[model samples]
Target: MAPKDPLLGTLKVCVLNLQSDGEMVTDTNPHLASCCELLELVLRKGLQQPVISLVHRDYWQCFEQLTHQDPCGRLSALSLAVEQTRVCRKLLSAQGRGRYLLRLALSRKALPQFITHLLHTPRVLEWYSPTTSILRNEEFVEPFMSLLLVLSHMEFKLNMENCSFLDESWLLPVCETYEVVPCREVGMALRYLSGRVFVLNLKPGSQAYVDKFICPW
Candidate 1:
């Protein structure tokens, strides 16, 4: 077919390294650990750069390729890389950096996919800290809310329950603070909790304004 993408090749190598080890990349597996470190560096750099450049070049292509090749395995590696890099924690820690990364990820159509892949996978979500407070942060509210809403839509499309990303404890607080509407396309009825109804819009980008609030009563 076409020449192999270098980035994709690198990702495959990392994936293979992890597979060959047959265990988590621990200190014992120096080679696998090094590969993971390199992968993290590449991902962090890609996140910092412009979406257009990241996608039009090779990062997105590599990601997509790895995803298609081994959806579960590659995603595991990615989730581990993100965790090791602490990229999300760092971004959420700073208003400016969080906003910048959120905007950049959204602009490139990467955030939704990343969030879905990161949170939807059973293995990954098990250990994921669904930090609800991040949703309340001023800088993160819009992007985080939007991505959650998007995830709701994807689940609806798959005939799955809405808000699959959040557990009951996290969902209640978020729904209380923010209006989470389900996607209309699924014909899913509004879920009511204690007389409070939650609705989601079908349109992908049609999330309620971050500052807007509705009385739950």
Candidate 2:
């Protein structure tokens, strides 16, 4: 159900558009870029008119800051994601950087992991004021994440190589698009989850782990 609040309602529409647009989203086409913009607008909508002035922020900018704040590498995944985006010789602008990382996460099927990771990192999460940002707001964040779980079923075949032009604009020449058919292994896993029996293979010497997954049943 869409939130009754007008702001959350608008965001829900954008999220639904992402699902309704098609089974796949790629920046090589402008339509996906348009959808990204709508999402971006909603994310920034709350931050745009703050009682205080702040730097023009993109989601990636938060990751960049998080990388600096976490020198110990406690959050190595965030650090690596930030580093990859930073070293991507193509993107020059923050907007392009954000889109690049977003698409990368989508294509890798790791967007949910990234979102959950961000929620746990308060030092970085504070950039978004709880009053305006959906990611920070309790009323809005859970629904947004639920919609993402719905998206988890769809395959995203974004071309990371096509990002060189993103610095200029989201629109770009078409490269290619494909709806990846799930491999047989995935199908087998689905069958197992559906109640098919399967044998387990566990190898271990010890570490308080031998009796855990290795015990007879």
Candidate 3:
């Protein structure tokens, strides 16, 4: 069982400080210890787990406190939260699964935050949710879907949802641009693609839109 009050007070202090001070937490600080500790607790058990909310409350506290900081440190904590949310879905699925809407809601809520954080550090996109299929390994369907949402919200003109399911026939098209052979990863790729469901051409020479995800490839 999880600790009943695992690191709760510590997190609160951090959050409060963040809200009030904001700038002080950016560089190495005494509070970073607390921050790291809280992250450890959340990572081990998960964010939806009671301990996680406690950590989250504190994380927000710290975020409010550290407005002057570079925001880099906070990215790890946020990423962990996103991962934890994803884990909940895995657990739900393992228990013989139910409707995807519940999973979608939880999954859907976490992406925007993660996307915003990564936007500050463009390279972070490669590590957290990469667009290049050739460089990306493993099935990171939710984060990638979330990425599509961010791009859509940004009005990038690509339909991530539509392009997500690039048909085997479409695979030929995807390959011509990306230099990647998607055939090997069909099933996993399709899972990520399912959200968009189909594709459309925006207009002549405007770029192809699939599931509303606009991609150069």
- Listed in order, each prediction's TM-score against the native is 0.24, 0.63, 0.21
In model 1, pairs of residues that clash are 181-199, 181-200, 182-199, 182-200
Per-residue lDDT of candidate 3, residues 1-217 (tens digit): 5222334455455545544544423223344334334433432222122334433221232222223334555655454543443334322231111111112222344334543453454332233224332113234324433333532232111212222222111211231232323332212112125233333224332222222344322
Give lDDT per model, in order: 0.36, 0.63, 0.32
Per lDDT, the best of the predicted structures is 2
On residues 8-89, what C-alpha lDDT tens digit does candidate 2 reach at each position? 5655566676677676765544456655565555456554333565656666676566667655767676667777888998
Number of clashing residue pairs, candidate 3: 25
lDDT of 2: 0.63
**Which pairs, if any, clash in model 2?**
none
TM-score of 1: 0.24
Tens-place lDDT digits, model 1, residues 41-151: 333332322336533322332333334444446465444433432333323222223233333342333555655563344442333223322322334434443533432
lDDT of candidate model 3 versus the reference: 0.32
Candidate 3 has a TM-score of 0.21
